[model samples]
Structures are given as C-alpha cells and as structure tokens.
Target: MASNRPAPQAPFAPDASEPFAYGAPRAEDGVWEEWNPTEESLPAVRGRHRVAKQRGGGLARSSTVLGVGVIAAVGAGGMASANTGKPPVSIALPDLPSVDSLIDGHHHTETPAASLSGVATATATAVGDSTADAGEALRSRIMAQAERQQSKADSRATAAAVAKADQQAAEAAAKAAKEASVKAAAAKEKAEADAEKKAEQARLAALAKQYTLPTSSYTITSTFGQAGSMWSSGYHTGLDFAAPTGTLIKAIHSGTITEAGWAGAYGYRTILTLDDGTELWFCHQSSISVSAGQKVSTGEVIGRVGATGNVTGPHLHLEVHPGGQPTGIDPGAWLRGKGLTP
Candidate 1:
C-alpha cells in the first residue's frame, strides 16, 4: 500500500557527499556577471587529467571506474563470485595486453592477448648469453697479455745467461792467450842464453887451438936483469935459451917478421910484429930462416939458436916489447895467460 502522508521535502542544494567543484565565473567589463545555470549551460571544472561536470555528465565517471576495475581484475588473474551473499567473487583471467596499447593514451576497442613471461624469459636468456660472451672475451685478452709478459721475462733471462757465458768465455780465452805469451817469452829468453853460452865456448876452444910454444925443447940460461959484464948493459935485458948451436927457433904466435938481419952486437935478429902491434925480438940467431915483412904461423921455424949476441954460452936471446916500447912484462906470466907454460 502506497502511503501518501506528505512526501519527503526535496532539498534545494545538491547532496553534500557527491563530488562537486565550481568553475570561475566569467566577467563582462568590470562588474561581476550574473550566474544563470541551466540544464545544458553549466561550466565544467577541470584539472590536467580530468573534467568534472554536473547532473547527467557525472554518470560517465561511474562507468569509467567500472572499466578500470575490470582491467585491474584481468591483470590479477581475476577472482570474483557468482553466488549471492558471498564476500568474494570468481571470474576468469584474460591474457595481458600489448605494451603499445597500454602506453598509447588513445583507447582501443581490442588489444592482442600474449604471454609476457615468454618474452621476458627470451630477453633474459639473450642478456645472459651476451654477458657470458663479454666475460669470455675479457678473459681471453687477459690470458694473452699474461702470456706476452711471461715470454718477455723468459727472453730476458735467456739473453742474460748467454751474455754471461760469452763474457766468461772471452775472459778464459784472454787468460789462455796471456799464459801462452808468457811461456813463449820465457822459452825465447832461455834459448838465447843457451846460444850465447855455446858460442862463447866455441870461440874459446878455437883460440886455444891457435896458440903454440916458442920452442919444442929448451933450458933456461941467464934470466932477464941478471947483473953481469955483458958488454953494453951491465945486466941481462932479455931471456936466454941454452941450446945447441943449430937448434931450431920457432915462432911463438902468428905474426909478420918486422926485422930479420944482423944487428949491432947481435948476429941475426928477428923482430916479429903481432896483431896488436907488440914486438917479439929473437936475438943471437946463427942463421935466419925468415925475412922482414914475411908472415909466419905458430910453431914455424924462424931462426937457429947460436951465441951471436952478448951471451955467456950458445943461447938465444928473446925480448918482449909491448906496443914497440922498450919495457916488457914477465914472459912466463904472459905465456901462462895464453894457456901455455914456458
């Protein structure tokens, strides 16, 4: 039954719980314009993302909220219930939409349904493959660099060893050469000394072979400086050999006969000139076998002994004059120096 007891009074202003906003009223000239809001003439209040209208335009907002709720449910694998009085509802999930449709800002009547997980999995696999390849390349470069450094180190070591070996070898060779040179010098000096000694011995042996005695056999008579009345000088001035009247008198050494003739108070005198200009005088000879300026060898007969000079008996007088001087050294000592005994 309808009760007509006085219907509830209609409120003059809009409901307070409803979303309401006001637009700035337009002004004509300087005065505030009169506001007249009809059914189709109300101004819309707007922000960057939305416009709020009055009366019939408010229903469009409710429908847009319903559409957004339907999209959210599909993204969450929609759960809704068909049973009345149930707290939760059950609904089938729709596939995810394409990325272009989600960001286009222009609405589309239909969006392609695809598996997002498949695309994500493929992209992740590709990223992993690229990362692994980059890592391997970096590792290869490091290994190559390390190998190069090691090779350089090895080369340096080998070169150092080779240089050391070469230096040692050179030193050894130099040492060997020095020793050989020293030995050669020593050998040369010793050989020279031996040759000099042998030459000296050979010279001495030849010199000994060239000397001879004045006479083969004879006896000393009156010696030199013996005091007596021998005519001219009161003392004997020469050595005397007491021999037979015809005893052979040979040359004592090789020389040239300088004077071989009769001299005053002497029968036949012979003066032999030696190599050093010393004179050997043979006086009181019975006969002379050599002439002046004649060469005579050692042991060659040059005269015969006789009592021709001032002598006490038949003997040969002999005098030695050095450098043709009138004085002489002892003949016995001179003959001994020549490796002979008189």
Candidate 2:
C-alpha cells in the first residue's frame, strides 16, 4: 500500500529574559516607588499557559516521495505476476532507523530492492524521523527551564539571611542604651539619700551641746505654784532650792547678767537675760560674782546660796519669766525640755 501522512509538529521555544514591569510610581531621582496591591486592585490569572507548536517541511516532502516509490514497485509486482506462471511471494520488513543519526549525516540502507517489503520499510522510516525530531526539541527546553528555577531559589535564600542579621544587631543596641539610662538614675537617687541622712545627724549633735543642768548637788525644797501658809498671796510663784550656806551656784545657760544688786525682801539678786528675752532670777546670794551687763557662760560661778530676804534658812530662790511676765511654771520640767536635768 502507498503511505501518505502529515508532518509532525515541532517543540515550543520560551523567551528567558522577558521584562515585566509592574505598576509603580516613577520618581525624579531615578527611583521607583513600590506598588502595594489591595484586594480590590489585585489581578488574577485563570487557566493561563504558554502553548507552542512545531512545523516540518523536510519530513513531509520526504514522506510523499517515498510513498510514490512504494506505489511504483507494487504496480511492477502486479504486472510481473500476470506475465509469469509462478506464484506471488509475500515479505516482511524490519524496524526504522534513528532520526538523530540520519540528520547528522548517518544514512541507513536495506537490501532486496523492487519488492513490497522494502517499499513499506522505507515509508515507515520517513514518518518515524519526523516524530523523533519533535520529541528531542521538547526535552531540551524542559531541562533548561529546570536549571533557571534552581538558580533563582538559591539567590532568595541568601538575601533572607542578610536581612535577619541586620535586625538582630539593631535590637542589641537598643537594649544596651536602656540599661545605661537606668543605672545613671539609680546612682543619682543614692547620692541624695546619703546627704539627707548626714544633715540630720549633725543637727542632733548641736542640740546636745546647747543645753545642760544648772547644778547637780542641789535639791528642790519648793516648786513653782506652791500653795502654803508661807506666802501672803496664798501661792508661791517661784522655785526654791534649799542647801547649806555658801553653796556654789552656777549659771544654767549662756546669757548676760542684766541686774546684779540688792532687791527688797529677796536679798542680793542676780538676773540673767537669754538671747530671746527670757529672764532667770537667782536670789538670796551671800556673794554675787557676775556684775550687771556681764556675759556668762554655762556652769560659771554666779553667786553663793545664803539665808537672805524672807526665809527661815539658807536657800537659793530662783524665778523664770518669759518677757518679764510672772507666768510661773515648773522649773524642773522647763530645764528637761531643753535636754537638761535639774
């Protein structure tokens, strides 16, 4: 039979470096702003694919020529059968040759020409050549695409690693700054607390030296505001210390003597005035050492206890007044308030 068939299709060719520009703003300094797509502005592609088709001129022409050769041989066989009285013989053909070797200058040949078997073999060989060429081209393109994809994946992984390292360095710097600030504030607070504690201790020490007891050997025989038959006003308004004659009397605090002379019914009197106008009077003195307007220190000898004025025995009479007003209070309690023992 005469063979007639169309040529096989070729493989598709893909463009490797096609430029796809997304929608982004153009800047004046040759910089493009990134475009971020929202759900409303995003584009979708459905069932999109790159289709390729191949065409062949050589395979189609060769197949047609081989078919004519086969028809001529078969017609010659039928004419010979009528001329001779011999019986007609049938034959089988082998497989076709590879298309790659044929294209590269390697042609194939079979023996026993001018027979139906040889003609059929040549026709099948032409069709097989076209199909094999198409398949080889497709395989080459697929292998090239796989290599490009692998290279892109490696580049993306390297970029991600560099970005992560930069982020970690920034975080470490921020944490160090925060710790330094906290340490500085704590140091300042500690300095202020130490200074305040030192000031309080100094104030207490100064108060202890400013006050002291008048005399440690004397006893209180009469207190302020005493009510007895010994007074014409029915109440004693001054404190009295009863001791032996010529007992040494000392100044209670630092002050100036404002009056040191004889007074009626009180014998020799010595009046001392403090800085704030409080006056202390010591009476019934056998002798007075401080003169008027003389400054005296604490524990200094001021007078000697005696039995002068309206008294039954030798004793020292003391009186305290604020601004010279006779508002008598317990002298023992007053001395204690100044951190002194009476």
Candidate 3:
C-alpha cells in the first residue's frame, strides 16, 4: 500500500537579481543559493537490497544469502543422481507468500535443504537392500555346486571298490577249480591200478587149479642158469629140487613119456612131451616109475628124487625144452608160467 520511491523535492527558484556562477564564493559566504538535482548528481548506493517475506512481513535479504541456498540445493541433487546412477530430479520450490498473506501471517513453507536430504536417504536404503539379496543368491548357487561334486566323487569310489571285490572272487574260484581237477586225476589213477591188480590175482587163481608142482616137501637147491664146475655145460641149465632119497616126482601136467632111461651124466631120466609140443625132462632121479611111450595124467607119480650123476647131494634136476629142442629154457620160469612156484 505504500510507495517505495522517495517524494520529489520542490523545484528550487533563484532570488531576483542574484547571479549564479560555478566558481568559489568570496570569503564572506553568507548568502544561501538553491540548485536543481540531476541523475548524475545522486550518490551511488554500494550494493543491491532484495526484499524477502519473513514472519513479520517486511525484511531485507542480501544477494549473498540467496546464492548460498541455491548452491546447497544443487549439491544435494547431484549427490542423489550420482548414487542412484540416474538423471538429477527437478525440485519445484513453493511459491512465495503474497504481501497480504505475509502481513496476516497465514502461509507456511518447507525448506529445500530438508526435502533433498529425505530423498537421498530413501534412495540409499533401497540400493543397500538390493545388494544384500544378490549376495545371498550367489552363495546358494555355490553351495549347490559343491554338493554335486561331492556326490559324484562318492559314487566313483564305490564303483571302484565293487570292481575289486569281483576280481578277487573270480580268482578264488579259479584256484579252487584247479585244485579239484588235480584231486580228481589222482583218484582216477589209483582206481585203475587197483583194478589191474585184482584181475591179475584172479588169473593166477585159475591157473593154480590146472597145474601141480613136481615134488612135495622139497627145498630148492639150485635155480636155472646157475654156474658150477660139476655141470658138463659151463652154466647149469636146470632147476634143482633138494629132497630125501625116494621122494616122489609128479608129472607137471597131462603128458606122454617119450623116453625113460639112464643117461650118462643125468644117471636116470624121463622125457614127457605135452600136447602143445613142450617137452619136460626129469633127471638125476633115484628111480623112474614111467616107461617110454606111456601116457601119464596130471599129478601122477613119475620118478623118485636122487643125488645121481654130477650131483653133490640128493636133488631132482628138471629141464624144459619147447618142441624137443636140445638146448633147454629156464625150468623155473616155465613152471611159473603154468602157475607152479617150484
């Protein structure tokens, strides 16, 4: 309602007949003179005065204070932008109160510095929460991968152990089989040997019933092929049975007497020829009970034992010749072939 410009001063009027000059007045200097003021003649004010509305309605603010408020607002906006990685947000300042409102004290306003501080705090809190969540997710993934690796390692170890056990079992089975085979082969060989011995015994029993020895109760004095100076040949060629004089000599098997006579060194002798053309000779006998060309049965009395003709004591000399040959074979072996031990 009041003007800010100052009232114009009344225009100055000079007194009649008084001259005005630009020079210095004389020393008396008692007269007063009026002059008009111009724009150039005004004294310069040092700085600007800006009016601001305060609670009391009228106050003056300096330009320096306004500049500081603006700088603080801008710095706060820049800090928020940098932290959030976005463009700076524009802030709208509240309208200044009208002159009537200020005079009546009816309007209120919030400071710009306080508003910016609240915005920055909220943004920082949101960023921190996001970072914490991401870290938790990464830790979970790492733990899962480690667990999978451990499981695979355990499975591999188990498989190796099973394979080793299987191999050992196979080796043991092979060894047992080899030992069983050796035992079976040995058992088979022993069984075969026993069977062969039993068969040989049976054959000897059958032959014993078909033949008899030449004289009973006699001892063997000499075997076939003995060496002695009393024999006409260099080596004796007969089996000798030593006995008391007149001991009976039997026919070894069923045979026919071919000769019954006294031979030179033999003294008394008898020759019996078998059906198979094998000749049996009884020599050095005390007496001959069989005649030439006589048929004698098995175990029949043929002669008596004597110490006759190139003999040292009483003994029966027996010879064997196949097909009436002059040279004789071993009589002991020939009798054994017929199942006769003597």
Give TM-scores for every candidate, taking all chains together and pairing residue i with residue i.
Answer: 0.39, 0.39, 0.52
Worst 10 residues of 2 by lDDT: 17-26
Distance (Å) between predicted and true CA of 100, model 1?
A: 99
- Local accuracy of candidate 3 as per-residue lDDT tens digits, 148-237: 888888889889889999888889888889888888888888888888777766776677776788998899978888897877787889
Q: Tens digit of lDDT per residue, candidate 1, span 206-287?
A: 6656766666568987677789876467877777777888899989889999999988786679999999888888888889
Q: For model 2, how does the per-residue alpha-carbon lDDT over 97-148 read when each residue is reduced to its tens digit?
A: 3332356323423323344365654444433443445446767788778777
Candidate 1 residue spans exceeding 4 A from truth: 1-208
Best model per TM-score: 3
The TM-score measured for candidate 3 stands at: 0.52
TM-score ranking of the models? 3, 2, 1
- The 10-residue segment of model 1 with minimum total lDDT is 78-87
lDDT of 3 at 179: 88
Residue pairs in collision within model 3: none
In model 1, which residue pairs have backbone atoms overlapping below 3 Å? 80-89, 80-90, 80-91, 81-89, 81-90
Poorest 10 consecutive residues by lDDT, candidate 3: 55-64
**Against the true structure, whose lDDT is highest?**
3
Model 1 TM-score, all chains together: 0.39
Position 40, candidate 2: lDDT: 67
Q: How accurate is candidate 1 locally (lDDT)?
A: 0.69
